[model samples]
Target: MDQVKTYRTNVRIGNWNEDLRLEEDAKNEYLEKKQRGELAAQKVEVLKQNMLRPVDLTASSDGRLHFGDVVMLVNMGGENRARSTVSINADINSLNKTPSPAIQAPCGISAGQCVDACTRTAFIITSIDGSPEGSTLHFEQSFALRTTSGFAMGLYLSSDLQSFQKCSKKSRLQEVNLDDKCSFLTWWKILHFDPQERLEYEGQPVPANEDVVIIHCKTNHALAALGDQVLWTTYGKEYEVTAHTFLDSHKAEKDTNHWMLCTAENRLELLNQSQSTADNQEPTEANPGI
Candidate 1:
């Protein structure tokens, strides 16, 4: 036999009072307390995402990015400070008719409502197959990059999950674990330019200071920096970064698809091609190197 259980919610609804009763005041106070609690939780989450996490550099001095290194994705397309490195752009718009930059470009009148789009952000590189440390990052295997706050970078998807983003394949950071199925968005692969060169170097470890195109593991679109589609961000005028592919039956963009995994200790500038020693790029944090 199935047991049926019923509870009482509005038992005193028959009583109507013109003046504010004691019970009404108590209920209103309780609602206010609950709302405060919810707001506190939201603020905590904001801090976790916006706060600058303390991450240490793990890239070695071997002139290659390893499997488990905390490196910065430096766009080699431009030399301006705004186009220096890729960072989070999860700024929410205010009630002043400002547009949201959660997964798009930032647009607003007041600078205070915007978040920093270039804050020297770093990401932890991990292998999808439990590859050991000190192992060079290769293209054949899948990889994931995560921030210290646990936000995994993934491709943007519509709420209905039936339609894909048009023209611009945008990406956003979603808090998820690597084992989660949704983590597929965080997985990506790298490939060197030049088909002949790539084929010749297939399965070979990719060098850190070389020009490479990063491809999304789930959508096959490549991460590209649009020099012509530059947008004004909170930081400044930055080259528009997007995951472009299959545009008007054409292939992905090439000129802006080059990126380099630069270490804070050893900055690798594309224009300058400065390969400094690892002694200066070594991080002071406690995270040991591979």
Candidate 2:
């Protein structure tokens, strides 16, 4: 059996002859409040429905690790501001927590001040097979650079994930200033990598591939690159492009008939590369294309 939450509102409608402005305004506000309350209730209901994912785990006093136990750890305030790690029995979860930068106090600082100067964050899973005193596993977290003005952070890697060390001397991190008023970066992806593949490349000194592209919402300002070369970029949209993906043809080699699917301004569009003569090349619009 399941319990259902109910939301209710009360309102009184006066006669047409009685033109009371304050009464009408109060009625409208009450209606708006009811609508918002219903929406919030729905969101909470969704979260409650998905409760199979446990929020936390605890270990027993006697140091023994079970076969099928799950452990989740969270690190606070890294360069990315937050990171989470989940270990399941013998194998580690695919998600990798980003590492925090080393904290160093300036010279001439007192010992107490030096300790206060370090506000770093990190999480280490000492052992997955058994207790911390026995297992011999090591985990390496990734790195990201965050800026102060905006919520966007740089992934900073070589042009090619395969040959990333070639141009490693330059600054990999930089600010992404868009033309449109974007609130923040929503979602991003590298066209060629899958979840497991992404995890495999995490331990490498240089990333496995660098065909990087950032897709933003509120504006269709998507920037794509192949190796170190910038292939395309667009900006100035009233709504953020919340989601995007490259169409998969499921073949070996690159597929020529592929197109990118972008969602923005409450619409789905099939965006194709257009060889325009304009200063900034235009992406061909396939309207109402599912």
Candidate 3:
């Protein structure tokens, strides 16, 4: 009789365990559904915010790349500066070259369209001025007399341009690894390109052709480049710029000249972009003050 009682007790415990397992599984499923619903709601909110308020990419700031601000490109090779306006387009390749003067005209091109009329080379914005007619983006270089289109004729986003407000100021900046996912508002030091020796990190090979890394800082700081001098101001304190170079196996070199402080707003912009990608959602506009 004792043996039979022991058997019955074992059976009861087994049944209890099974019921508990089912309860736990149901709880997990409910939690997952709730999370998914919250995510969907967040995405809707983002879309709504963007639809209600569009961003202007030409507002003026003290040498920082702000939304709606027009930038001029100076092709140092030819000593010619061309004018172009900044738009809300995320694709930076949209800007095209115009006629020989390469000045900003009222005409606009769609994203990915090439401006076939001017010479292309890496240029810097020499002067930034704005007006209602349209902001003037001036470059520093003049084109050759040839009518041929230059391979470099496009509005290339400066790799040095950072979101400034996204990264943490206390973190040490270093070269980004292939598998590394860069967090928002973190500073990273990049090595400029060099043709001689290839760059390696942690015994793994890194490509030398691309910009070292994207860094985020605060927007309240000032960023300026004069000749070789790159300057950044934080809390009203200014810092001098320095040059760093790196090389990779592909016979390409990467170079970096200076640092800039990215603002909190910029950091949010980057975070939104990153979150959109990770979650397969789209970015919506937010209030500038937000």
Candidate 4:
């Protein structure tokens, strides 16, 4: 914020020597751009970039998840053939078609678009609460997970909500545009392996980003990777994901339901946030029933 202010001030009244000041002939141009909000917008953009940049990662470099943290959702205990995390297939290459043409999810976007899990894709964990871009994320706090491309990790339910809420069908592990929204499908909450211990340490920093269950805020179901429901992608075969829960009392939550917001430290290149496009709007709070 201070940096942006300094930049704005410097641009308005030259901070350099007199030689660098706009000539008298160009002073009017500067005032016009400033009045048009162009200079203000540029300053805001700089502020966003600076605040969103990590001051420093969680000490361990792989744990202590924070809001706005770029990460890979690593599936550890699942029946996955290989260790991986949640990812989306933009289908930039023609290597794909709707794997399930007849099926659709209520995510309000391309329902059948491929969303698979692998280690390659990166995600940014965020919240619409207006925290200063990146802040420490606490346990049980409601937050939205999104791909850098601007698709938020969420699901939607039609009238027969339960019919479309399970991981068995329709692949409800879906993404919607990240804007001002209060939908339960897009808001998620994380829980520690021991719910009791979670409460015991309620406001404290969530230990390492390990052994957690990410539940859909509305349905109270878990984000699950269906290892068996594999799909072919530009990255080859990847696991299909969906919101799921165990029905039978005998069937407890399995490793398939467990996940880690594994750090993207190993990512060969850091995934930067996309520049805010015209679609960017003031985010409304998604705090209801949170």
The alpha-carbon lDDT assigned to residue 224 of candidate 1 equals: 57
For model 3, where is the 10-residue window of minimal lDDT?
A: 139-148
Per-model CA lDDT versus the true structure: 0.50, 0.23, 0.26, 0.50
As for candidate 1, its clashing pairs are 265-281
Candidate 3, position 65, lDDT: 33
**Cα lDDT of model 3 by residue, 44-151, tens digit:** 443333322322222234433322322221111111211111111211122222342221211111111111111221122221222223233211111111111122
| Pairs in clash, predicted candidate 2 | 161-208, 161-209, 161-210, 162-208, 217-240, 217-241, 218-239, 218-240, 218-241, 219-240
Least accurate 10 contiguous residues by lDDT in model 4: 108-117
What's the TM-score of each model vs. the native? 0.54, 0.18, 0.19, 0.52
Task: Specify the highest-TM-score model's number.
Answer: 1
Query: How close to the true structure is residue 15 of candidate 1, measured as C-alpha lDDT?
Result: 41
Residue range 241-283, candidate 1, lDDT tens digits? 5565423224434545666676645443332343232334566
Residue lDDT tens for model 2, 1-290: 78775644544455643667768987998788667543444433422332112222323223322222222211111221111111111001111113422111110000010001011101112222233442321113211111111111111111122124322122232212211121233222222233335455443322211222232322322222112211111111111111222234552212111112111210111011111223254455853323
Kindly report which residue stretches of model 1 are placed more than 4 angstroms away from their true locations once superposed.
Answer: 1-55, 78-82, 92-120, 150-182, 230-236, 245-253, 268-290
CA displacement after TM-score superposition, residue 124 of candidate 2 (Å): 18
Error of 4 at 8 (Å): 84
